[model samples]
Target chain A: MSERVSRTTFYKRLSRLWRNGDSRPLLMQALVVLVVLLLVVWVINNTMNNLEHRGISTGFDFLSQEAGFGIIQTLVEYDESHSYGRTFTVGVLNTLLVSSLGIAFATVLGFLVGIARLSANWLLARAASVFIETFRNIPLLLQIFFWYFAVLAALPHPRRSLAFGDMIFLNLRGLYLPQPVIEQGLMPVLASVVVAIVTALVVRATIRQHRLRTGQGTIAMPWLLLGVLVGMPALVWHFSGATLSVELPQLRGFNFRGGITIIPELGALLLALTIYTAAFIAEVVRAGIESVPKGQKEAAAALGLKPGKVMTLVVIPQAMKVIIPPLTNQYLNLAKNSSLATAIGYPDLVSVFAGTTLNQTGQAVEVIAMTMAVYLTISLSVSLLMNIYNRRVALIER
Target chain B: MSDQMIPARKPPKQSVGLLVWSKNNLFASLPSTVATVLIVYGLYLLLPPVVQWGLLDATWWGSDGTACTTEGACWAFVTARLDQFIYGFYPQDHQWRANVFFFQLVLLIGWLTIKATPGKKWVLGYALLLMPLVSWWLLYGGLGLKIVATHQWGGLMLTLLLALCGMVASLPFGILLALGRRSNMPVIRALSTAYIEMWRGVPLITVLFMASVMLPLFVPEQVVFDKLLRALIGIVMFQAAYMAEVVRGGLQAIPKGQFEAFGSLGLSYWQGMVLIILPQAMKLVIPGVVNTFIALFKDTSLVLVIGLFDLLAIVQAGLNDPAWLGFAVEGYLFAGFVFWAFCYGMSKYSQRLEQQLHQGR
Candidate 1:
């Protein structure tokens, strides 16, 4: 009985020490929590009071109202008579359009510039360096403004437009190019094209299998090209009396007619976004390519690969592992920066939905919420896609 | 022993002349030589026009476009509007107040950044708390000098003020948020996460729009903040999110051993952070912080969208002036050069800091 009582006393002392041992840190933590909660509460109270005093109803019911703005270069059909929701759809599509074009052009230019920077030719390397430094240092918005207000705006009017070909022209008004119209029996031609692609893949797989079974193989590229390229066109021509034709842009009074027109606004925005972002992308690409060791090329050369083959087969594949993450970052930045197009009155996502629709509906909360949600989704998805790509290319070790 | 056997060193070879250097570097092969010539020609075609238009044929001394109707660039628009570009519509007589405030700010920043500030910690505290108050008095001038309203402030002055104030306010808030993100308590972490994600997910333009239009509705009726101040707050809040992310990166880079060491020494978490974690983390991330500052400086141009006449906005305004019609190129080029200089200088300085950190390591 005495031993049991001693054990209980020991347990009681241990509990007492544990309670007060970490008390000070816990108290400081509690104080922090208290301050945060109190501040939040105060702000919310103030906001509600402010809203009530201003008589502004803070709800999101206005999204269904008619939006009175038109967006340029929308992927989907849209009209000013549509609801704000539809306008937002158009805006998002336009944003995606510019961003995708910017990404594609910037990637190609960036790779070329990056390679040129590492060139053996002295003048070419210096030129690339000058390009990178000059473009990257300037503000992107200023470049956009310069292109819009200075360069593109100074082009000759439609009557005196610069002609590229019988079918194409460049002018202050817009770029005019022939638009393709689907002829009868086009679906069968498209089906044949798809079939050709599938057959090429099958042939490629069979070749791979044969090479593995017996260490002898033949080049499949010529056959694959013939199947996909020549086969489809031939089939299309035979099946549908479908003939390719160009509708030349003709000047009618003040404007050009008889072709699809790309406005100067879109042209300026695309040019500025591509050129400005390409400078940054070029740097990222250069860093990524440089991060791959010279020994990689040496190894490929030592294995009897030609220089061009070594670059394509060995050097680039490794460099891509380094290139993709920062490339995704540049793409995201381009998408975000496209919002600056609103400054130039380009009917982009921000201008259509955020500027005009917000003004009409006065649903500041809902409109802003939608706008932010779209960008966030774009940024998040691009990052997510890159993460997947990164995992695919990442080095695997035991 | 060494004199018995020695390796002979030959004189440098004849394959080291300028011609050889040119061959190796520029004309390593036939294709490279062609590439060099083509690039030189391209530069030749591009550079001369720019030089002629921007320098040789440029009009430097004039106040209007009529004085520069020659076959040259009329740069007079920029010069004529230089005052508006720098000080906006701030009353001309009281421009000295803004100048004084800017001077004091520079001094304060210099004092804080230097190594030999007497009583370093307390002086820094004073600098942090006092500079803003003194500058405010100098700017607002309610106590003594003539009062200049916020709306009258524009151009580079407004841009600098907004950025400086935003940075000053955001730093402490950013630190707190960063600490909260790493806090042991679930509530604190969640709160910080929500705060950071909310601000970060939205673009700065939308935030500015909210501050200008929606914020008024959130405050009590008739309790109006200056439009510029509202924009300033938006900038601070948005920047704080980015700053928090940067600080969090720095915090994550700190080794766990440092934390454990402090804990082993019977230090509280706050004590550990103040004494051990921050100094090391900050040193590791100085370059990143400066890059953020550069980005923030560029982003200040967005205020133009909200109808504030910043440097870019003033230039845009100048472009539309009837007297300066068709001179948008000159105006934009001037603005671009200014922005380029500022950003490039900061980026170079950051690079230097990065080099110093490498040396330290």
Candidate 2:
């Protein structure tokens, strides 16, 4: 009788398991997990065997070995005697330099073009449209080629460099500008600049709070902030005995000898990234501006707000909601597109670590994995930062 | 009273015509006038030279590089290498195969574009399933035809082939991924999410590198993948992740009531999805799909990094040739123009499709 009862209970439990919603999905998931695991295991096994047969070690020990190649451009001190790890860092820094510069230039250009596209003047609008269409339609790689092979390469040699005043030169090699030499007292100037920025932020916050509480606006904050930021730095530099010296680029054998030089590869990559991304950003900016309802502008004007105040308080704030998302995307794309510097031998992460290092070490898997991880980390961090900003700008409704 | 009406006076001078229009639009404020004058001056300084260089002084036709002696654009170089630019090193005599394939492609695309095409389902099936095979056979040459190595395929032909194949191959995978991501099963969703995010997060260059270098290690020792095939696989994988996100957006737009309606009919999950859900969802996201295609089209140039002689690569190669020295400008301009034309055309078409679909809905 006890055995019969146990059998009945077992059957009931089995039926319940089969009939439950959660159990079905759990079973299906388990099967899927098993299949995926099997595939991964097979691939790993194959990779191990292949590596063994090919006599290529699968670890990342080669990163510590010397890199015997010279990079044309580097943000940090690097030489052939440096390790592959140093090469990787140089590549990452170069990429960051180009991408950051590209972002800054593109944002300015994009905003200009975007506003011009909506200009009251027909000629201005048409010109902006033409610019957008021309840049947007062409592939970025081709544009890079245009700048590198055609434009920069076609420039005359250093002996015949194009001079802008006494301090700047452009030639086949690169743009050369006078390098600034800061003297001992420059720390005071730098400190004052930092202090000015913090003071500006505090002042702006106070003004915002005062306006919110009293419904009265103070317009002096921006001018005051600008004065503190620029005036204080200038005063410190002038009176604190901080001597600024310029080291002009001297023409040497075949190239300029001493000064800051922007290599053609970096120049071309920056130009292409800026122009191409600016075209897309212009569209985003245009769309965002257009997305703001006409009523918002009218309502602000009806409230007796000044033209600038109407734009700042009503139109731009609303437009930010639409613009921030797409703007973030463009910034991310600029970062990713900077990888194309590889094609032009720009010594970017992909070119240095993935291309040269991998070729030297024959550690394809490890090199590629590392390069990919760097990009993934950059992408994730950018998105996280942008998401926080987006949340603040997002419309709040009760 | 009509007879006594005063003769119609000329409209107040500043109320109409060019003067008023300019005043109202261009010179309305100090800033506006400044912007107008600056832009006009910039255009005046820029436009004439570009026109002269691009049109008036440009060389049109020549047999070789000598015909392009002038400083202006050497269209002659473009003319000299036009065939190579279109067909790459695709054999001189077998170029007809590519021509025929392109012709077939045009017809298929034309048919697909027509709103009232008869037997739409069957036509779509034929175009999607059979056309790729036939085109592949023709282009690659197998079974009774002379086989053309994929390495020989370059230029515009290679570009189109990569873009089309990537788009076609990615669609199914992307759809499945999108579905899996939205599935109730935890493991499938996690896997799909991981795959999609990883692909989307990294640049396509790294992906291509992995495919070119590391893929061989992942497969068995005996297995071989052609260079083009490996690049294509990488592109397909990378694009599919983006396509999945786009498809997921479409899926989310579908109302829950549609699922309920399917359930009311006692339809299975797959049946409901295949028949009702996906059709509506895909229809909604046609513009997104086309945009992805445009992006893929542009991205095919990256294959050059993997040593594929695509159109841009061919241009670079031509520039390197001693015969075509100092003609990088013309070659690059030509390549850029071609890419621009194709991308711009596709974008306009997508915009039109979006408008039409919006109206239909």
- Please give the fraction of native interface contacts (Cα pairs under 8 Å between A and B) kept by each candidate: 0.62, 0.89
Give the poorly placed runs of model 1, Cα more than 4 Å off.
Answer: A1-60, A69-74, A205-230, A233-240, A388-398, B1-14, B101-130
- Please, what are the lDDT tens digits per residue for candidate 2 over residues B81-178? 99999999999999999999889878887888877777877877887678778889999998999999998998999999999989988999999999
* lDDT for position A145 in model 1: 90
What is the overall TM-score of model 1 with all chains considered together? Answer: 0.89
Best by TM-score: 2
* Residue A35 of model 1, lDDT score: 94
Q: In model 1, what is the error at residue A382, expressed in angstroms? A: 2.8
Q: Residues A4-54, candidate 2: write the lDDT tens digits.
A: 999999989977876687686776788788998999999999999999999
Off by over 4 Å in 2: A1-20, A216-220, A395-398, B1-27, B115-117
